[model samples]
Target: MACIDTLLAAFAEVAVDPDAQLEKHLAAGKRVVGVGPYHVPEELVHAAGAVPFGVWGCVGSSVEAKKYFPPFYCSLCQMTLEMGLTGTLDKLSGMMITGLCDTLRAFSQNWKAGMGSKVPMIYVTNAQNRFIEAGRRYTVEAYAEVKRRVEECCDALVTDEALARSIKLYNEWRATMREFVALAGQHPAEVSVSARSSVINAGYYMDKAEHMSMVQELNAALAAAPVSLSGYKPIVLSGIYEDIPAITAILEENGFAIVADDMAKESRAFSRQVPETGDPLEALADGWCALRADTELFDPRKEHIEQVVELAKDNAAAGVVILLAKFCDPEEFEAPLVKKALGKAGIPAVTIEVDQSTESYEQARTQLETFADLLG
Candidate 1:
């Protein structure tokens, strides 16, 4: 097994420099498709002989994107557009955008208008009512269209064999990630807050198989190492994204160890596995339909509230920290209910408003410090 520090450094390097990773793949003559936020069919891209590069917004100000979006729009969508407009994503062979929420729905239109033909845009619409027979059929057909578009864009065939292989690889990757999260929680001192985020975030910019191998090694290293007795305050995090180094730094300074999370960028992306048997497209659709407790998905029962409470209790977390992304309507709408549920369950929780452009984290530090005190 590789040294834990060495593995962590590798992940941190890749996590912070996804552009370099994209360039590296481009230099290798590999077709790269940019996948936007939420549940996207990355397996199709892999089967189509291309890299599925994540296009989650970066930490930066949105200048050019302002013309396309209002000030009230979420920074995540805005910065993503800014990257495309600034030619930062010019090298991408194609871009796949999902209409999971209102902001993302508008983002797709803006990306089409702004990027034009410089990069191909494949728009995907997911059915919110995903558990019914109609919804399942819709998912399969929608994903089939995505497969067709991906094949056309990559100039390669998404044959059943290739798709099946990709599905198996992704399922294995997901299972490995779930293992890593549990291991990381067991040894938080070895995996610092920022380090834990880096390891998971790195997967967004890397080949699933490659990232999984490194994580498997890291998991082994962590398992062999002595358990953490640091007595840090364990907490569960819920958010659209929580990979920001500054935010993690605050949690680390406040002596918080994230044992589990509902972050879309982390566990939410890998909490469920794709079915390995039967039709690959239907399997992918079933995987998406299986997703629960996410703000993007339709949950009329407000099950996410109880889910957060259960996660905190299950992990023995003293509290829950919500990294509320600014101007994200779905998360904003769901935050109150989650807080209420946690309160009823006797789980201490705090919400920190997060934005991509904000350089200052002093407010977050203060809030987290208070939260830490409360937990104590």
Candidate 2:
């Protein structure tokens, strides 16, 4: 329990400090690359020898960013641009954003104009048609350009060997995280909902190998701990983001435990590891194709819904919560279909809105409490 507590504390420290890694990299005179949500080829950033700091945006409303887009845009984009304009991202040598959705597509341009040569912005379009050969080729080329941009920013090259090593390291970390999530599920009493977020979110702010060592030890600790059969409702969470403060606590307050999640910021990012063989970038491209269909990408077969269903059934979840990021159009469109599928299957479910600067969880607590009672 002591070791587990230490690990959780360390991870929580990193997760709570938004600019810790960036400051460290700056102090060391190392180039830091800022990466926005959805899809970013972080391997390319690592291969270029720059730190890849996740930019989920600041947790407050941004009056400056309002100038670029309508008020309807999600807070993630709005606040990230706010940070960029407000000089919060001045330490980063470059930033990467994907055109995965309409808001992100527009954000990339707004960022370039706002920064105006202060920080270079790399633009990438994730191949939605990734199920096909042409799509794979297009993604590879897009990654190649990302590689070039990062290399230029760092004044270094993403060599094939370095890229291959980065891929291997990332896969190793992903495997360790996979082990942690599985163990966390079996010992929900110890993990707690916030502890789960700590263990997962902390990795984004540290070097992969460092994060791996910490998590590997925590996984071992969890494996050695006693299991509990508590009267908490277990559920699978599917959504664009899980960085909202107090979300896990709100669920725990309602006698619920998050056993698993399909959150883009969490498990979805590492659902499949890149294959170690062949070209590293190519392997990464293949790995993208293998990812479970989610709101960001096109799922011609609608396997994403089935993936959600399978997660709940396999985890024996009491229900599934589709935590939609507010004003996110793709996730908004998927809500009804998600509800319909789970409804037909006789699965308990709820859709909750989450934002970074959530001042209150009262409404969410009520919804989850109602769901828990219905399941009971």
Candidate 3:
């Protein structure tokens, strides 16, 4: 129990304070590359002998970023730009920006204009038609370009051997994370809602291999411990991101436990692993193309809605909660469809608007309390 609490605390600390992690790596003379949302090929950065630091934007107001974006911009992009503009991320050696959504595409341009001089930006454009052969080829080429840029930024050669090693390491990390997620679900009494989120969020800041070791230990501990008997209501959480303590606290206060999630920042990020027995770059491309049920990605058949339904059913969830990021058009467009699909499947769901700037969660607390009663 002591070990479990210590590990959880460590993860939560790193999750909430990414700057400390960045400075720790920098102090060790490591080159850190900031990676933006969705996917941006972190294997290449690892292969180039640099750390791939996730830049998901912190929980804060975006005052400086207002000059670049309108009031309707998503807080993820706004806060990320705010950090860069305020020189909070200036210590990063480079930044990798993926244009997965309209807001992110615009953010790429705004970041280059605002902070290009302080930290170099690598704009990565993924092929949306990724199921086709031509699309796979295009993705490979794009990743190759990313590799080249990463090499240039780190002043090192990204050899195929190194890339293959990095791919293997990342796959191992993903598998370990999946195991940890399952363990957390099975023992919600031991792993609180916020603690489960922090464990996953910490992966964004720490090195993959290092994070995996800690998670593996935690997983073993959870597996050995007795199953939780707490009267927590298990549910599936679908969102772009939901690491906000205020929001998660409300869920826990309302007796909710996130047993499964379609959140892009948590389960979605590790749902697919890079195939290890192929050309390293091609494997990376294939992995990225294979990612499913994500709002930022293209889904012509609206399969993402069914995917959410299936996720909830598979986990035996009492309901589904959609943590809708305010001003995020992709999630906004899909929320109704997901809710409709859940309704068709006879699953209860609630959508709550969330943003980084909001300090008050009273409305969310009330909504969730009502949802909890409905679930009961």
Best by lDDT: 1
Candidate 2 similarity to native, TM-score: 0.96
Question: Local error of candidate 1 at 202, Å?
Answer: 1.0
Instruction: Give the alpha carbon lDDT tens digit for every residue of 1-376 in model 2.
Output: 3488788988999888857766877787778888888567788898888888888886777789989878878899999999989888888888989998888988899998888878899888778888889989999888888888888888899999999999899889888988888789878788878888877888887888988999998888988988653777888889987767667777767767777788888888777778899988899899887775777888777888888888899988889988988888888888889889998888889999987655787898888778888877
Alpha-carbon RMSD, each predicted model: 1.0, 1.6, 1.3
Question: Per-candidate TM vs. native?
Answer: 0.98, 0.96, 0.97
239-339 in candidate 1: lDDT tens per residue? 98987778988888888888888989889888878899998889999988888777778998878888999999999999999999999988999999899
**Between which residue pairs do clashes occur in model 1?**
none
After superposition, candidate 3 runs with Cα above 4 Å error: none
Is 1 or 3 the stronger prediction by lDDT? 1
| Model 1 Cα shift for residue 278 (angstroms) | 1.3
User: Candidate 1: where are CA atoms >4 Å away?
Assistant: none
Ranking by TM-score: 1, 3, 2
- Return the lDDT, model 1, position 257: 85
Better of 1 and 3 by TM-score: 1
